[model samples]
Structure formats: C-alpha cells, structure tokens
Target: MEEEVENILQKGGELFHPGLSVDCVIFGFHDNQLKVLLLKMKHADKWALPGGFVYKEEEVEHAAVRVLQSRTGLGNIFLRQFHTFGSPSRSDRKLNRELLVSLDLEAHENHWFLQRFITVGYYALVNFSSAVPRPDATSEACAWWDLQDMPPLAMDHNHILQQALETLRKQLNDQPVGYNLLPEKFTMPELQRLYETILGKQLDRRNFQRKMLGYGILDRLEERKRGVAHKAPYLYSFNKEKYAAALQDGLQQGW
Candidate 1:
C-alpha cells in the first residue's frame, strides 16, 4: 500500500497524487442550535475533521462512513455525496509537518506525516437526539462545537466546514435539512433555529410556523412541552420515510 505510483498526477497515475483519503464533517443539532463534531489531536490541541484512509479492498464511501463512526461513535446516519477537493496546495492547506511533529505521533506509532495524502470530503447528518460521540485513537477528545462560534480549525477544515454548510443550504433551497439536529419531537422554535443556523438568517415566527406545518411532513406527537409562560407547545417529528420519498420529487418552499 505504501508503493508509490510515481508522477501519477502528471501521467494520470496514482503515485504523484499520493494516497487518497476521505474526511467527513458530520453535523448535529441539539438544544436549538447547530453543532459540528470535531477531534483534537493529542499533541496539537487544535481540532481537525474526522478522517481515515480507504483500505485497499474498501469503497471510498464506506471508508468515509467508517471514519465518521470511528471518531463520532455514530453510524447508519443519512450521509450525502457532497464534493471532492484536490488541490496540491491543499495538502499543506491546514496542518503541516511541523504541526504533526508537535502531536508526537511518532511516539504514538501513528506516523501519518510520512505519507502524502489527498482527502475527499463528505458531510453527514446525524441525529444529536440519540447519538453519543467519542474520541478515536488519533484524537485526544471528540466533542461537538457550535457552528456559530467555531474556533479556527486545523488545515483546510474551515474550508471543509464552509463547503458542508453550503451544501446544506443548497439542499434547503429545495428540501428541509437540520432534521438530524432535532429531537424525535421538537417545537417550532427548534425547527426555526435549525433553519436559521444553516441559512444564517432569521425568519418570521408566524410565517415559519405556517410554512412548516403546511408542508404536511410532520407528525404531531401526543405530548407537548409544559410549564413555560404562555401556551404549551405541541411536539412534532418529521415523517422521515415520507420526507425521504419526497426528495425523489421536489419540495416547493413557496419561493
């Protein structure tokens, strides 16, 4: 697997491009906000996207799913094919040899720096409602960071995050995302927060409610959140199977 293909990029071989890997930027929403899952390297203290190399016998998408599961401890979530980034400069785009040296990976036996890598980026949607995240071998910790106040991430990860967000927004132009960030049941406020976070814009409360309900994709739960100041809000959940089917058609957002 360490065999170099030599001048691969120039001759359409794999060697010059180095080893190709896939990194996943998984996002989940909870408590009425959007959050990104991140892992901090042991020595660097700086966070990087969850990533792993494709096994010789494994599929690229499968490899990405495996990496996301390895780091976030959540699997079988809905993931989409977003984009592939291949810029030679992107290799040194975020962390470099110096950064990896600080991580002391040599001592940990994870000498990832020696090999050249080109990563394909994939973003997944996970339900924060029922997910428990954990750190993998290369990371000191795995935690959720709110997108609104995200710190400077390592490498082109900030670009990765932006790409994921843009993909999500484009999805929203036709369909509703952020369902993974919601609970099995949530209020309109929770739904609105998810949209606002992704679109980076506030919407009218009443109009938002009218539009969401009118879509007829939600299943009103029997119960409601209690003890606020005004009226108790009813709980709601998306008909995932049905909503998924609708994607084959089209979602009219009333323009």
Candidate 2:
C-alpha cells in the first residue's frame, strides 16, 4: 500500500497536470432511494467523492471518465460537467501531510498532491446494480451512501456534492434523466420514484404519469409485471431513439 501510494504521488508530478483535478458525484438509483458513490480514506475517518488528477495529455472530460471508471468499474455512463470549484482553501496541505505520515510514507513539502487544486465537478447517473465499486490507492473502502445520510466528507466534498445535486435537480427540470439510472425495463411507479428521490419531493401520481407519457419518450409494454400481491402494473421502457432526442432537445416542460 505504501509503495502504491508512493508510485501515485511520483506519477502525479510526471504524468498529471498541476493544480487541476476532477471530482465526480456518481449518482445511482436503487430500492427507491438516491445514492452517491463515495470513498472512505485509508487512514482517516472521512469519506470523499471519487476524484483524481487530470493527466497532462488527457482532456479534462476524459480524465473525469477515467476517474469514474477506475472507482466504479463501469463505462459508457451518463456523465456531465456541471461546475468548476477553485476556492483557494479547498485543499488542505497540512492534513494531506498528516495522512501520508499515517501511512508511513514521506510527504515532501513540494509534492504535487500537496498543492491547491482547482477541480472540475462532474456528475454521473448509473444503474445501481450494474456498478462494482472499487477503492483507489488512497481509499480503503468504496461503497454507496444515501444522500440524506452521508458522513463527514473530506476537503470541500460536501459542498461539491451539494452543488452536484443542485445541478442534477436543475437539469431534471429541463431534460429527461432516468435512462442510465434505471434498468432497461421498469414500471412507471419505479421511474417516478427515481425522480421523486432526486427532486426531494413527491409528484402527483396522475400528473407525473401524464407528463411522462405525454413526453413521447416511453414505450409501454403490453405485459404486466407478474407475481405482485396487488394488480400488476404494466412495464415500460425508454424509446432509445426518442429518449436520445429528448436528451438533445429539452423536454420543454417543468414539474
């Protein structure tokens, strides 16, 4: 672990751009709740968003994709750049040095990782069951945390998360957003639950269904979901072509 940390720190100076990083708020939907992927630091009792430095040769967006893939083991995810955070105090050099010392690794005063970084904030929507989370070199555990029950996060991550969620909520008002966060086939109630979870409020069932159906982006299947105690609800799936078009063109209505 120490060697791996050393290698990453050394590589940061050689292969990554200085003073620039990418932090991703990877959102997932499962069990009718909204979740965000987070990492628990190895030697600290703190959680953080999945993030990393930008490689010198990589585009800022590609670097975000690489970071997300490394942490979540999923590719082709729905990713978006929402904002840039450049607060001078966002990075804490003293605490970073302490963490390295805890790992019994040398923390050089001039190390690139100790410098203040201006990070690009991105958010990704992925199917909860599809992702296999993996910790990075600095993190000991990688897992999902409910948005409302998140623990103390490191650095400016809590602020970053708030901004990401705000961006997601605002985007929900303008565009369609459930294709990647849900299974290929789902029920209307399931889809509505996902929206309600992100929006932090319940939508009127009839109105939500009418609005969704009116968008012309869903294909209702004739088959009903089986084995339910109550009357089975019909299954629905996104019409990929229309869904993609809706994503490109705004939904033109808000809840």
Assess candidate 1 and give its lDDT. Answer: 0.72
Listed per candidate, the RMSD to the true structure in angstroms reads 6.1, 1.8
The 0-to-1 C-alpha lDDT of every candidate, in the order given, reads 0.72, 0.89
Candidate 1: tens digits of C-alpha lDDT, residues 171-217 = 88677665667767788888888888778899999998888777778
lDDT of 2: 0.89
**Residue 221's lDDT in candidate 1:** 89
Each prediction's TM-score versus the true structure: 0.80, 0.94
lDDT of 2 by residue, 85-168 (tens): 999999878778887677666787787878888999999998899899999988889999998899999989999999999999
Steric clash pairs (candidate 2): none
